[model samples]
Target: MVVGARLEGIQLSGIRKMFELTTERSVNLGLGEPDFQPAQHIRQALSDAVEKGYNKYGPTSGISNLREALANGARKYRSDITANDIVVTTGSTQALMITAQYLFNPGDDVLLPDPGFVLNVPQVRIAGARPLMYPLKQEHEFIPQVDDLEKLVTPKTVAIYTNSPSNPTGGVMSIEDIRAITQFAEDHDLWIVSDEVYDQIVYDREHQSFLGDYDKVIHINSLSKTYAMTGWRFGFLITKAPIIDKLSILNYYTIACPNVPTQHAALAAMTGPQEHVKQMVNEFKRRRDLIVDRLNRIDGIHCLVPKGAFYAFPKYDFNISALDFAMECARSDLICTHGSAFGDAGEGHIRFSYANSMDNINKGIDIFEEVCEKIKG
Candidate 1:
């Protein structure tokens, strides 16, 4: 009874739970970060910043130069964007954490995607809002539609979270999908919380962001995935609202400020050579192709080729629950996520991250195939 009612139903993330179950022999596909090291120039920049004494507390809204650079990058999406639009945080995770709390009220409803990131549900709940899940059907290529939202929205609905190159499923929303969803939100007068953390890890085609399409968007991004600086934990939030002064004050009370040297390194990351970023994407593409092709060769599995991100989410014609299928894979010394860990829409699927080396990906798939055979019986 001592615990807050809002925290009552919340539990640990199923993704991290699978991760903790990893054994020394486990081929870990359960986690969600790149295996690549921080690029050479990025590392050098952090060293240089520390040597020059950037170790003290810095700006709460992030370093001015980094903010300017991010604003410049985002300006391509919206012409009027400037340094005033950014709020730097510990990570995109925190960006998400704070944004949900800032936007939602005690009784409001926020539409979310089913088979979406696990964090969306808890974040909204803790912020005292109800999460209304809209489905992304495989028949529709795992994209969200206005038709789906029609049933979910009510007068209490306040916002919707949009993820492109979505986690687990690796489904990217199309231009048409983006425009329609934006128009729907406009019609309903709801905030659009857009998470585009995997924006740069895309394959084959350019990924268009959802940020520029609407005025009510609260856009999120970070250096964690793009520069392989996950440990550095740098992220920023963007909005046209003059409310950043208020958000930064909240960020100051909440996170103090992002690490000083990491901010310096982030500056170099945005300004450094384009080669390392390109190389990382190319490597992920190789892994993406490898995992999808091999998983398809497994008789009962069907994986859609992901156009972006480092994940391969495949549906299998198995009688077992996704959690049980994942548990079976764990027994074989391989680790990946159960699809339902995302939501009910994900029940028959499993998610394999291709962020590991090719050797490990192959080894993981080999173990997964054995699990498939066991389930077939």
Candidate 2:
């Protein structure tokens, strides 16, 4: 066969599948990217860097100042986080990919959240490993249960992935849940890969991270969601210092090095005016409120209020499967991701990203209601 067997069954992400189907008139909400542009200062910094002839291959571990800035930012989670602990990657996604490739071996099992980020499953498989799952139940507000995790663990299990201010569900882990996960990882002697991309996007309470002084904790984060820097593709990983050196070698071979201009831009984002982030969070909270209220207004839907991130995963009483419902919405010019796209536990639910505007979300919800009415009839 022309294609490699390992990549044979892996399909394009369900979110992207819906996203590619959308037209300008589609009232799209399929993707999770921020609607806002990167902050002005950040943009200017990029332009300045490019104009100043800074476009070159940066250090494989990234520009030292940028790494230092990220390390400083991470200090909030663990006071000891420093430049020595960071390996800047193309994005948080790459950090995750490197982690998977660097650690997982065939026959090893990595426990993932069943309704977790799509990357969590594919990355491990791509590394020639199996992904075991623990359900993130709606009843538990989408938090993983330690008992459930323990049930999935065996001699083969190597690591676990956790996301806070989660993507599809927007479930920010409660402090109790955070403690439970941390303790569980400690007990099992498993590596805790924490994805904190939405760390600064919380609504209700503070985002408590899994990045505390544990050496086994591999913390992955980026400016994509936080500063609307997805296009910049700047992110970093914090782990044991030795592991940072190891991942940096893989990072060098994978991308050679992160682009220089963007590293400067990311540094500006890190050090620039704080008001933009605060303002953005406030706006997201308002959007979240609007989307939840409108989603709950639909006759057969019940939306769980998201305390963080920009997506709403709403459960529906419709007889149709989540994929069919989402496709029906898309056919009707409304873009959404099927709940099952998240995982099996997400069935009967649908993910709507409100990262667009209030006007677009209103239009999408109207299309959703129209679809519901036709199906119910």
Candidate 3:
């Protein structure tokens, strides 16, 4: 009855714990899942696939149509990618895990942004590798500073994990920053694992994929956030076919293949009319503005107005731990993720998702303000 040493450092996600408190009465600010269901056309696509007996195992690299569609989508951002470079995955989570497993050896150091997606550190750890944290400074609007990342590099460093329109913070990296990071990766001969799941959700800026001029970047994307298809478990990875060959072998042993009908659903998600996506982004932007404004009106609280994504990471001057604050909020029928759940770098903050309706968001803020007052006294 021996557990693997590779999993010793990993724990269940803190966001999951906060999610358990959700009820009809609770204002759920935790978890980044979109409140909307997949558009009717996407569901129709899934139904059509199932009716056509598309439920069998798909190729490990995914169906050819879906792969081609994904490549076309990538070309809108980076012109050189092709279907051969794409490997449809079960989800961005699995794609990231497979990439980590393929790119890192035991005891290798992978640089990760502190206060990153909660799974980022654990994914590296599960690969029998160490995660070195680079600061995403509050002073820098939560963007990773090149100097800070450079200072953390060591002989064991093998890769850098980057997320734009970042989770919890909603900070999108600029073109110049992307170029600097890409140049740094080139200079060091390190691989870049780029998480661009929120590529379509940015408000003020365009997404600049690290793969723009860099062949060293491995791009991870998902239909979950873009098409509101989280439960469908569909995503894909982009890298050279040589790396895709290795990841396909890993996939054969892991998921065997992504769900067949869901891949068809994802194909529809990719090639279908993109107006639904644009509408979703507009709604999210409105909610983001609403939540940031409401949080800023609270005394001692300052929320950095996010440039992209639907989550806001708000800093507070309260003299309490983030976990304690979150627990108290949960007791008051509010569920928000604690900042420390992200990392030590996030200790004094809390993450709020604006994925819910504007009415619910306002209600949640009212509850949050009341809780703040109660705690202050």
Candidate 4:
């Protein structure tokens, strides 16, 4: 018998290698990474830190100043957090894993949205827990239904995973929706692991989170999207004292600590001039509007204008599988992620990332239109 079970066929390296192979000649839009570089101030901060010999390992949780900046940033959404309740992780990915590891047991059920972030479901499974999916209807703009979520809970349910300004779908759950879910979790005594990495990139509406109202919420965010610091791998998690302590101990054994230089860079990003972030969000909004309008005009494609984030999840009329459509687009030298890669509920949809230059966005849409027209014919 196997001594221990390992998570099979779930390596990020495999996906990355496939992406690298396809991107060599393709106009790649398959990644969630921002196309922009970190701001000059952030780069200078990291350089200065390196010059000053700030390369030594810091605390397992995070450096003092960076933790303070993270706490300050969290106050905008919910003012209940302090540095003591924060654990700076390598990225939101690690934060999610730590939460799953500590909160879940074998055969425990963790609820996640259908068509959710692909890695999250597998992460729950790898943590020795069963993943229970709750459907987010297209008619509802892909927002989580509180009633549906409430129905999925059982004694085996340990936590619920939610992403606002959600991946692939670009769905931002409203404040009221968040309140309902949090109340349900509170009533059920379950943990709410919310991924708010795209919280600052919202377009039409304000971003909301449950960290302020509920103590059982574990909020994870990063500087990757908003600050264009994906390569920096800097993220932080906020939870109540007990959960923070639990995650911190697991983090200590997993990665030991996040990079010192990246921590300094994140501090600069949090405390730096707000103008850069505003510029990026404004630019993304422009791209988003352009893409949504163009997609709406196309035959057989129905796209909901996203309120937050830089993605457009649009349904196509052709009965072909989402993977087939995505592959067809890739064959046409235009790259986008297939909805089915997210989950079964994602069938008949495709995700378009607008994290490219305006010129690329226009060209990419043209290519997509041409390919789609051919298919319709």
What is the lDDT of every predicted structure here?
0.90, 0.88, 0.89, 0.85
Clashes of 2: 0
lDDT value, residue 3 of candidate 3: 70
What TM-score goes with each of the models? 0.98, 0.98, 0.98, 0.96
Off by over 4 Å in 4: 1-4, 9-18, 21-25
List candidate 1 segments past 4 Å from native.
none
* lDDT string, candidate 3, 253-342, tens digits: 889988999998988888889898889899999999999999999998999989888899999999999999999999999999998888
Candidate 1 lDDT over 1-377, as tens digits, reads 47698898899988988888899999999889999999888899999999998889988889899999999888777888889899999999899998987888899999999999998999999999999999987778789978889988999999999899899789988778889998999999988999999888788877877777477888888889999899999999999855678778879989888889999899888887879899999999999999999999999899999988889989989789999999989988999999999999999999999999999999999999888988898
Q: In candidate 2, where is summed lDDT lowest over 10 consecutive residues?
A: 237-246
TM-score of decoy 3: 0.98
Q: Please write out the lDDT profile of model 4 over residues 219-274, one tens digit for every residue.
A: 98888898898888888899864767778899899888889988888888889898
lDDT of 3 at 131: 90
RMSD of 2: 1.3
The residue-level lDDT of candidate 4 at 230 comes to 88
Return the clash pairs for model 1, or none: none
Candidates in order: C-alpha RMSD to true structure: 1.1, 1.3, 1.2, 1.7
Model 2 per-residue lDDT tens digits across residues 55-109: 7776889988888998888888889888989988888999999999998999999
Clashes of each: 0, 0, 0, 0
Ranking by lDDT: 1, 3, 2, 4
